[model samples]
Target chain A: MLSEKHLPAFYALGALLLIILPWILTAADSSYLISTATRLVIFAIGAVSLDLLIGYTGLVSFGHAAFFGVGAYVVGILAFHNFEETTFLGFDGTLTGLIVLPLAILISALFALIIGALALRTKGVYFIMITLSFGQMLFFLFVSLEAYGGDDGMMMFEGRNILPAIDLNDRITFYYFCLAIFTAFFLFCHRLVRSKFGRVLAAIRQNEDRMTSIGIRPYSAKLLIFVIAGAGAGLAGALMANHTEFVSPGLTHWTKSGDLMIVVILGGIGTLIGPVMGAFVFLLLEEFLPIIFHELGMDLLKEHWRVVFGPILILIVLFAKTGLYGLIFKKEG
Target chain B: MTQLFFEQLLNGLQLGMFLFLVSAGLTLVFGFMNIINLAHGSLFMIGAYAVAVLTNLTGSFFLGLLLSFPVVAAFALVIELLIIRPLYHRDHLDQVLATFGLILFFNEGVSIVFGRTPLFLNVPEALSGAVQITDTFSYPLYRIAIITVGLMVAAILWFIIVKTRTGMRIRAGTTNPEMIRALGVNIQALNTTIFVVGALFAGLAGGLSGPLTSVEVGMGENLLILSFVCIVIGGIGSIRGALLGALTVGLVDTLGRAFLPDLLGQFLDPATANGIGAALSSMSVYLLMIIVLIFKPTGLFPVARAA
Candidate 1:
């Protein structure tokens, strides 16, 4: 029913341009474009993982940022100790930035495993609140940990570990590394969705009761996907800390979770690439809207731009059934 | 020390009442509408603003209190008609996002209109002095008045809900919206009324609280989360549950902050005890919530059905 030959050549052109735009934009804007793009890519990765639950699995987690924050805190706490110091484990203390990422994933996944196991038992509004309650639990934990800069947050004075062969701190190189990670994740997520596992996830999304009728335990599937999503988000958080060289409660705030959800909805659910585009738009709006408003001497509007942002959401949900991606590509003729 | 303890208990009760005022409407909205309204706090903020402005305009506390109900309820009606009504048909994510967006909008709007500086209101002279509770403890008469007023309001609300016709429709609609519709109730009007009731409750809390705390921009944001935790721990929709949850959270929170340092000081060095105490104090409420969730996933007073 579908053929690569029939897909528009312009689609390929668009993808190429997306990749190239960052390179050119970074050249013109220096590190801003690269860092911004990297941030968008990181958030996009998290969003795709969320898509596995929210889009494919039909599970909505208002507390997804708990994982994101967990990943970030792990990176922060590790670096707080390991920035220049040796570890208690007796291993070489100075591993590269890439080495810390998997650790962050495991730590975040472990936390998610515990929280999700309990949270998944409840359905509907209970599910939302339980997840939120767990998120708040973590938030207060971080807030109370005056040991790690507490509410104000700590700055990473050190950047990513310099690979023995190549400098990891170079803006362009770091940008590419992040870009490669994003591309790999996108492809991985694409393949994941096509796998038979994706089909079960979809079935569970449609009806867990029926899935259980067929002998597939929905709880394990939901928990597994939740942890996977958490791991994915955790990776994004690790990259986020490395890219910005700072980690704060801002990463874990419920509002950030809401922002991530907004991105997924804006990009269109069930589509792997939608969140990437959505993240791009959201970050672009954050970057540019204030500048435009300030330059126009409407600085008052700067603080209150959500007045405009809110209406955009109302309009988007009302008029655009899918999202910007859906609007642009009309479900393949 | 005994006096302070007594005072703090009263303070905790006062805070619990404020939480109740906010939580009652929030719980009703959540329980009946199945809508997680993050913007409920915005209504609280709006109520505070209303009180602040009215107090400034008329220089009368009663006038401000009197006016906030209608103003806040009217605002709720408009919001319900425009934004929230449509969301009833959608899923929780949609409701969450739209309400969250409303939070941003309302917070920024208030900040712009009212400025970031905290607004202060003075309690009327009639309620200002301390009442001699004990020889060592002289609690603020104003706070005592707040407690009396809060208790009265809670009682009236209980009475109205348990012994009123409108409350029946709300209870019915919450349990079964389709059945209520099938019974030919005007669900739209009923929903708007319940939303208004919720708004008025929040507004009343705000009006009552303006003198006690700083009425500044973004005041409602954090309180919103805390109150949500209350309802979640209380079980989503039960009035009695909300009250119990609020009192429990208020006491645990206050007691932790008050006594945790002293408790830890006995075991550890003073500095470490202070740090650990503060951390534990902040965490104790959430710990209680998680413990409750662990044992009773449906919350203490399972409203709809046990999970």
Candidate 2:
């Protein structure tokens, strides 16, 4: 009854459950669960976007978090300007989601274009290191911007951006809003990956030489996918900043990229729904690991769970070739 | 202005030496083993921590430095055998992720063991005083010593890599591992040796840097990125490239940080000048790297592969 062939039905059932999760939690008298679910959906957006480049295009970008950070900063900077009643670079910083969300996506895409253009010149480990350096450069740039609260980061005094007919202030409304965007984006990505462009990306990943011989320029193709991924990450960042009402330089840190990479890997790279599963598992572990350690009376272990997490990661790389998604799907097919 | 220029130049050279110590090992590993060890920074951290704790116990900085090499080497040996060896054949992403996992592990593990408080290591009394470089400019003796030690190690490494029998095998291994294996060299043992040696160099950089900077958890990470920049700019897998790249990075960073704000103050408002200068100077090395990549995608000194 639960074979690999029925995976899509299972995914549909899971989506239905995710859709009604907040209601179920509210009925169970758990308001906090809704917030966690919101975070899961937001991070899943990022992880899934990253999977586009890493899983499909074979571009291991260690700076994907930079786009995410830039997106959040666009929201944060605008809000900061609005709160201070100051014009930012000759424009009134608006808090309309309609304006800000698109702005976030465009700015992030532009950054990805520049960085990806340069970083794509190098291959393999060099690409990883260069992307990391670019990310760090952005991180430091934010840290030095004293106007935007500098190293301490900025807070959103104004609530969520206004949307006509949508009261985002309500926890359930915000959660569902995020879910709606995430679902749409996920569908877009699923369809995109199955398209001709996705086929070109996969071909480049498998054999760039062959693709080049076949008249496909890998650079433009990879760059296109990279921008798409950045835009997706930017959307996630905008939503995240609204949900938390805060933005920090930590969002762009290399470790944040690593976390996203972990989600992709844990979910099973190249799988459409795998990143969502990965984000859920990662967030759940982050939430419950401390409690699990506390129950065992290992408070120090609870605090330093990464000590255990590191070896588990190594073991996963060495042993689990397909990851958790593969385990659930029973086969990669 | 001339005195200040010379002083900043010396500072740059000093920073370059510390970078060279780290980059050399990283380049060597990449060249021969083709493994990108992200936990190389953790090895640097271990070196500093070992020296800090040992120096505190023994009351001798020299003894602590001497002890750190073996300790770090042993740790690296274990890691190489158990962890890094398996990763050699895997794709770069898996290696990056696994090693990244190691970084998280080591950072937290050190934090757990050493506590969250930063550890301090003082320059030895013999090296603490300033040395007169000129009539108007005096340089710290400890920094000069770091430069000297780095050069000596560089020379020694050159000798080993160029002239020694082991060096020939390493060179061969880098160009063609299968051929070297067919020639009766123990490629496994050679890899193990190279890893240990690289770890020792990283450890040395950390141990030496302890007195100059705060010896704390995660300190090696920033330095690790800088060293990667060095290798990338100089050309991956080439010792000459690492040295050149390290010096270039060191000079640019030191001189930029010291002078950029003042330089910008003349053109812009002081507040904006300082803020923008700080950001730009921090970004200067990476900008250099990007420019180099654009002009020479392989790097400034790419190692030649055997046909």
Candidate 3:
């Protein structure tokens, strides 16, 4: 039986795996593997941040990737300005990770604050649709910015941002950077979900009326969590932009947000570590499903793999309500 | 200037009617079942595809249109039975997830079958020409026909909902499902009927609009979001709300796109004006929704039960 006592050990093992992933890949002479692992870590950051809202707070925001896109655009826009040697608004665009990442988080948090304040006014499916509208709004806004390449997206041709005391240009160093940030974020979320605020949010999710009866206003709690989640998503976006060296309006599309939601559900809703596992599994399936089909001599199936993926997702939703993580760590009486 | 404004108004009306056709079904399904059918758009796509394929095969647009309603409804009935029925008892998130999965299935399935190239459906021969509306203005007859058909459907729907026995049962079911179930109404059959009816409406909208737009995979996705905005603004589950919401969205979207850039160009550079205008026009409906939500969280015409 899985017990609360086992959590720390589980986390420790996870940390160990993350720390050694790059080394293992390097030793295996698999640069591609290292890059794929980096992508997983970055997406895990996004999935975990999204879980903070959808899983913990019960806010099924269909626009979480808006913040993710905001983060990436911040990095991309700043880099674009730096490349042109121009000042945007007032500040000279800097390629420093320290400056850009914090800016990304703050900007995304502010966007979340504005969006969440209005979205939180409604409950249930209304909230979902409102968030999706906001996401689509941001997507169109980005696409309209012709200076940033519009639909074509922007590329950081100069490569990764500079961090003091470390070379981000090195693939291995970049991998560690992402891992470290992801670790910090995971720990923060772990503590947040256990904190007083998180409990209040969880209570609100269960029954907002009861919380209100207890003299607890659920609105602020929900808003705070939404902003925090957005900030985390923003940080992930910044890392993603750095990793891919590209940012596009597609990053904020409603479909990307749906993908994030799928990751949260596929792992385990409201479980802090579940999103990380979910991201890993989701990306692995995306990577391997086509290869597996090809190996089976079904090349046509490989091209239309989503036909298979969709049914699997439906089955998971129907049969594994608690998700893959819950199945693995079954609760005991 | 007046002629141009009127022309845009007519375009808005045509678009609004199309939106109503889609939103009406969505509102009905959501009202009673309390399920968010993301794959509702898939039904719309199916309708358009059905019309396109059938029309091309038969070389008769009218016959294709006649055949698509039943074909799409049958498809929806199967989907409701095999997929959507189990989800009726699930939470909103699960419904959203499952329906979202269905969307992927339908989109990819269509792509695999149709090979991704958009299918074209021509305007019917009789409805192809433009009619003079004013000394300076001529509008396409097909668009006017759409508006007339939309109003007719709306009237029929209003009559069915307000003046029929089944409508009473549906309204009762929405307000109190358990009470209606205890009253010996087969809630399952009612729900399935409503789902199929919603699918029929979506497919009809798709078939009718196919000639106006390209019939292609994923074409319904964007329209689905817009229809959602209409439902949210008009108040979910309220037919009156859906009609009002659809018109408001259609007008705002059409007029905003037609004139906003020109308005902005008077003050700003053309490039900046164009950029900002496009962004604002695209966001206008959502902006209206946000404003409406802030003032009326339940929407402009929320059903009594929803409140």
Candidate 4:
């Protein structure tokens, strides 16, 4: 792996490139890359948070997209009501990021608290199923809501949230805004996994019984991180809603949770920057693989890229145990 | 209203039978092999597709159903050798990821081969009409046939597991694979047998349900999660638990969707109640699962050795 002391230089290089990517894309007249980068950054945020839970804490929550959807729905619902000039539960809808962002975080964190309290009681396959069950419940709940477009999903015509000093309606501006958020969360997770609390979580993952014998209850620490991860995912969700201008039950589907997990694992679990890199690689593959297939005259493969993508994923799980990051930054002898 | 209630109950039973067929194999795989096979759903889908294509070709649904068993079993055998055999020693996370990858490949592969348009399998002529259970109540003949077959399978499985020598060996294997291996039994072959049998049942369920539900690319996925709910609620590694859990989930899901709106309308205005009821009913099974886990974390009938 990359040496500990050189990690900051890698981070600086990544940051510098991300900062100039949109401008470079614009110069190339490939402004669509900005939106793509925005999606990558947003998902990177989600992947980083998931890494904290699955990698650092060793809690493989299969239902994490619930928080992501919850955050998007907060933004989506508020934007919908704001457009309709209606009050939802005696509160007028507002599009201010200052209000909506915090609300999204708080609500998603609360969701994690309730779900964590119940699901944390189970371990191994049971925990995975219970979390998936809750995620499905939330997905069906959203799908059943006819007022929000139900199975078809809802679009925000009123546009992105209002933030002070940032015009998020501009694609480049939003890309930078999302990059900033990703950087903040990425750094937060980096610090968190190194802290004393992080060590406890690591210990709990390594051997819960030993941790329990040492008087550190695994439940509370796990719950705490679950909430934190949920909150971070919620922030990413809100950004996702703004980026797409659409929200649907699909956002909360268990498959979305699976995708987030794939991102983490593909990037290299337990490493903050790995998921960030994984996000970049994942979206790039999603974007370019079909075009590449089309260029190669494999029209059938182009439309069914997942046929190729799936085996690649399987091979990664089977052979690339350390992931793309670990492969690139091989540990020195 | 009573008639409607009875009809919905039968519908729930039929749904439960499907859940049982799928979850039985899943629970067995989890119990014996200690693997979480998400691609089990893909097997169900292939079964549906197999039966659909064969039925269309042979002009006989029963023939198609009979043939799908071997087809799905063959596919299962291949999967066992290539993907699952290596995964036995890996952790649950790896199994989940690999199987999840398998789901993608299978779903997309089916879509590529079969096209995205949903396939419709006609109910075989003999079972197409309704059966008069009572003067006032009639149910689809096909549905009743499904329930009967499900029960028969359950009984046969019980007999095999409880009475027959093979069943005893299977049970012994579940409880103590190493001991069975020490006794000169081919444990790997035994595992393969259980895996293929499980796939056969899942295939059977898919072929049976094809007529009632549209045969589609991802048809197995929704049912897959519901079966997972059944397995979780029933307790991992317990066949009896799987049955109870499957029936409970099926009945609750079907009945909740059928009656929740009207039930809630009685207490509140129709419009608001309908909306909330729709959401709540959709969530009812998950709520049931959460409540069950709260009370019995190991599931209703958790197997001792598996735990």
- DockQ (C-alpha based) per candidate is 0.65, 0.78, 0.79, 0.81
Candidate 2 local lDDT, residue B31? 90
Docking quality of model 4: it rates as: high
Count of backbone clashes for each model?
0, 0, 0, 2
Model 2 CA deviation exceeding 4 Å by range: A1-4
Q: How well does each candidate superpose onto the true structure, as a TM-score?
A: 0.94, 0.98, 0.98, 0.98
**Minimal lDDT window, size 10, model 1 chain B:** B298-307
Clashing pairs in 4: A1-A330, A1-A331
lDDT of 4 by residue, B1-307 (tens): 9999999999999999999999999999988888999999999999999999999999999999998888999999999999899999888888888898999899889989989999998899989999998998899999999999999988988988889988888777777777878999888998899999999999999999899889998889888999999999999877888889999999999999999999999999999999999999999999999999999998998777722
User: For model 2, what is the C-alpha lDDT against the true structure?
Assistant: 0.91
Worst 10 residues of 2 chain B by lDDT: B298-307
The residue-by-residue lDDT of candidate 1 on B81-199, one tens digit each, is 88998888788878887888788788778878888899999987678888887676688888888788778878987887788987787777767788888999998787788889989
Docking class of 3: medium
Q: C-alpha displacement of B151 in model 1, angstroms?
A: 1.5
Runs in model 3 lying further than 4 Å from the true structure: A1-4, A27-29
The residue-by-residue lDDT of candidate 4 on A1-333, one tens digit each, is 566567779889989999999889989999888889899999999999999989898888999999999999999999999999998899998899999999999999999999999999998889999999999989998998899999989999989999999999999899989998888888888889999999999999999999999898999999999999999999999999999999999999888999998898999988888898888999999999999999999999899999988889888998888887787686545
Lowest lDDT block of 10, candidate 3 chain B:
B298-307
Q: Which residue pairs collide in model 2, if any?
A: none
lDDT of 2 by residue, A1-333 (tens): 245788779779989999989879989998788999999999999999999999999999998899999999999999888889899989988798899999999999999999988999888777888898899899988888888988889899988887889988788999999999999999999999999998999999899999999898999999899999999999999999999999999899888999999989988999868889989998898888888999999999999988888888889888987878778877624
Tell me the lDDT of model 1 at A221: 87
True contacts kept of each: 0.60, 0.73, 0.65, 0.73
lDDT digits (tens) for residues B8-114 of candidate 2: 99999999999999999999999999988889999999999999999999999999999888999999999999899998889988888899899999999999999
Among residues 3 or more apart in sequence or in different chains, the pairs in candidate 1 whose N, CA or C atoms overlap within 3 Å are none
